[model samples]
Target: MQANIRHQVSPYLVFFLIYNSQVGVGILSFQRTIAAKAGYDAWIGVLAAGCIVQVFIWVMYKLLGKANGDIIDVHTNIFGNVLGKFISFFIMIYYWLASVSVLIAFIEIIQVWMFPTMPSWILSTLILFSVYYCVSGGFRVIVGMSFLSFIFPQILIIVLFIFPLKIAHFSNLLPIMNHSFMDMADSIKSSIYSIAGTEALLMYYPFIRDPKASKKFAHLGVLFTTFLYTISTIVSFTFFSENQLKTTIWPELSLTKTVTLSFLERFEYLYISMYLIIICALIALFLWCSSRGLKKIFNRKQKYTLLLLCLLSVILCHFNGSFKDMLNKYIIQMNLWIFYCYIPILLLVLSFIKRGKQNDE
Candidate 1:
């Protein structure tokens, strides 16, 4: 299915799409998780992970540039048709799993912190339906939604973080590099899940008006996400001691509790509401990618594929129990392997193949 010229988004929207995708629920809790592994120097791990992501983005652009198409075409170019379709089918499943995981996770958060009495399935239905609406409108609508997601919450959220400074102990960040190199490396590995979203570019690149011009903007998105994560890590590290951080699940959310306003109490509640916009943007992007993959692999319409995926997401969200946590952990592990290990290997294979073909010419 060729993307219509009327439907293609501008090159610069790539920045918002990549940035919104990367800065999801992961940023809210990543500090504690990484700090648990590397101690105070975990902020270093954030920087390292960002740099690693930049490299992967470069590799992805090179691969896509060679194929002159999306990842489906890349696979078909590298592997034969039958094998490529099989691999792309698995990628569709991977994208579905990612959508389900994000939906369930955000539902759990709302249930725990905002509305304990509300049924999980109700929120799940609402959220999935919203995602379906945006995705069914096509890629341009998804891009517009992502732009709003990036602009709406960012300024207020960053301002809220400033309140924590009254109680922040900058001294908590002292003795930096106190952790062993191996520990910091482990933290970087752990941080990969939080930084995993840029790989979506492999699938969406062909939809951009000028795919080549978007490369730098895409890298800028990664840089922007890295800056946000680094700032969050440093703030969390400064606001809480090592032991305190290890115990806090959502350190960023918890930090909002310290903010006192004249008219509003429980500022975290407002923050959570604002966060739904980001979550919606994330789920929409994943679902769109999944549906588009299905269309490519099976010669089906995206509308039907999107409806199927949205229903599946709602079902998964409703039935998710203790297993939800396990599934999330496994998805993170899969993402780490897929983006870090598999993509690089694929790039090398494509490079060698291109060189051999050039020699034959």
Candidate 2:
């Protein structure tokens, strides 16, 4: 299922997609989650996880390049249509649930910080409206939103970290390896959800012009975000004490409290407001991938698939609570197993099958 030439985007744009996809709600609160056990040493685990992601990027290209299409193409080629679409459906479900997880996470932030009495459905519907618009324009528009996300709010957000550094205790990161190896593993495990969006590439491979040339850019994108998150982790760790971070729900957002000026007050309100662009772009990318994958598997129009997905996302967001937790738990486990563990093995099996076919021919 090669995308039409007009539907395709420049290979370099993949960097923006990969970067924006991974930069979702996790960054605001991940510092506390990773530090839950590893304490200050968790930043090291982030670096290690970045290295592993780079390796995973290599594995994805090897597999997708061989298939010359998205994951659905590879599945049908190897598993036959009936069994393949069945498996692909589950992957699409994961992508859909992933978008919902990100959606509710931001809604929770807005309700807590800005509008305590606002209903979840109102915010969720407003967000999905933007997501539907971008996704309806096709993959290129989604990628463009990603590009804007990096340029606008992302740059400004990165600059905001400087204010926190003025009061940072760099010495807090001392004795980095003080924790046991198992503790480091726990930190890495927690960071996985924050850094997990790279796997969205599985569905969009065919939409990139000259995907081979795009591979380096994808790795670079991951590298940049990894560095970004690591720095964020260090900033959060340095700004707050170990015990304080544990109690803090959104450490990075709280860091905005330090930014004060005579002209303005309660910077976190402004901070959360600016974050709307970033959140919308991330949700658009994930929903695009999910809808596209389901469209291919079901042989349906993408608009119908996308609309169905948007409606489901709103419904799921409205029912937030234990459901959000359950959704995230499933997504993280599927991400780890489906991409990290299964993809490399799939590459090996694909290589063998291609070899056998060549011999028979």
Model 2: residue 341 alpha-carbon error in angstroms? 1.0
The lDDT values for all models are 0.87, 0.89
TM-score of 1: 0.97
Screening candidate 2 with a backbone cut-off below 3 angstroms (N, C-alpha, C), the clashing residue pairs are none
Poorly placed runs, candidate 2 (over 4 Å): none
TM-score of each: 0.97, 0.98
Q: In model 2, how large is the Cα lDDT of residue 263?
A: 79
Candidate 2 residue-wise lDDT at 230: 93
- Local accuracy of candidate 1 as per-residue lDDT tens digits, 97-193: 9888887888888988999999878998888888888888888998998899999899767777798887889988888888888999889987878
